[model samples]
Target: MIAIGIGLHNFAEGLAIGNSAAKGEISLAVLLVIGFGLHNATEGFGIVAPLAAENVRPSWSSLVLLGLIGGGPTFVGTLVGQHLVNDALSIAFLGLAAGSILYVIIELLAVARRAAMKVVTTWMLLLGLLLGFATNAVVTAAGV
Candidate 1:
């Protein structure tokens, strides 16, 4: 359920990127996609981390569903973004995304703490943020 929610949220972000690009906001679109793709790579790891820690392999159906939840949004968002690009709407969407992602991070941290893995959780969170920023920087540098 959480995975599906996260995936749908991600898809909405993708929509923003696609919408911007469709409107000829190429630079913004490219930057958004690059940043989103970078963040998503970490998200993939997040999805499997708990299972991996438990030494349990996710079933094929589960993996497929996870992938759909995680990736289906990119296509949908692209289509939506192509059709809409209002600055206020984009800002609102971003705020919503940030809030949801932050909640997920907090939940992950709580889980890690309960498992007595505080250090690893802290580092991973930091690394995720750094990677996100780094990717955004590169995209910005490229004038995208």
Candidate 2:
């Protein structure tokens, strides 16, 4: 389920990359790819962390399938988004992605609360917001 949510989010990100490429903003597209690559690296760990916590050793094939489920939509979205190139369409996809990720975050927060990590959750939330802002700042500074 977490992979599905992340996949949806990645799809939106793919759309952004594709739209940029479609508009001939190759630099922006490249930057997006680099940024997303870095972002997704961390996400892979997030995807597996719960399983690791529970001592669930997923098979290699299962891990591969999960990877595909989480990342494959980006390719599809890129293909679709390349041809669309409309602001409204991009916004709609992003909105959907946001909703999906919010659901995941809410679920995770519930689990954290159950584990008595309220303070930690608050700090992590703050750190996440800061990281987001920092990433945005870097992207913006790149003149995109």
Candidate 3:
């Protein structure tokens, strides 16, 4: 489920990348890829969190499939945007991503609550937000 949700979220990121590249915004496109690549690194952990928690090692084939599902959209979006960039399409993709992320966040929060480490979990959530922002700051500093 997390994989699915994050994959959807990544679709939005890809849309941004695609649109930028299509418009000849090379710098912006490169920045988006760099920023999004980092974001996706963390998302990989999120995608496999449940498996990790259970001490289950995912098979190579499974990992491949997951990677394709989560990252393939970037390639597809890039192609589409290169040929036909539009605001409405971008908005719709982002809306879908937002919905998926919201659902995943709720589910993860429930899991944290069930673990009964409310204070620690809350702090971790805040820390994650901080880390995400820090990453964004780096990209912003790069003139994005």
Candidate 4:
């Protein structure tokens, strides 16, 4: 469920980029997509990390659902963004994404805390965040 939420948040962000690009906001769209794609690649690991830690493999159905949750938003967001590039709309969508992501992070942290695997959990979380920021920084530095 948490993975689904995170995935949905990611998908929406992708949609925003695609929609922006469709509307001729080429540079911003390209930059956003590049940054987002990098971030998303790492997010895949984040989704699997908890399962990996528990030594449990996720079922195929769950994986599919998670993919849809994470990637489906891009399609919808693109359609909407292309049709309507209102600042208010964009801000609202972004806010929703932000909120969802925060919620997932908190939930994951709570789980980690309950498990009492502080060191590994903290390291994984930091590693995920660092990887995300590093990838984005590279994209930005490349002027993409």
Per-prediction TM-score to the true structure, in the order listed: 0.82, 0.79, 0.73, 0.72
The local distance difference test score of each candidate is 0.73, 0.78, 0.72, 0.72
Each prediction's RMSD over C-alphas, in Å, is 2.2, 2.5, 2.8, 3.1
Comparing 1 with 4 on lDDT, the higher-scoring candidate is: 1
For model 4, the stretches where C-alpha displacement exceeds 4 angstroms are 42-58
Task: Please list the residue runs of candidate 2 whose C-alpha ends up more than 4 Å from where it truly belongs after superposition.
Answer: 24-35
Best by lDDT: 2
C-alpha lDDT of residue 82 in model 1: 70
The residue ranges of model 3 lying beyond 4 angstroms of the native Cα positions read 25-28, 52-57
Residue 29, candidate 1: C-alpha displacement in angstroms: 1.2
lDDT of 1 by residue, 8-125 (tens): 6686777677767766878877877777777777676667766776789999999888878877877887787677778777776677667767766665666577689878877877
- Sort by lDDT, best first: what order? 2, 1, 3, 4
Backbone clash count, each prediction separately? 5, 0, 0, 4
Give model 2's clash tally: 0
Which of candidates 2 and 4 reaches a greater TM-score?
A: 2
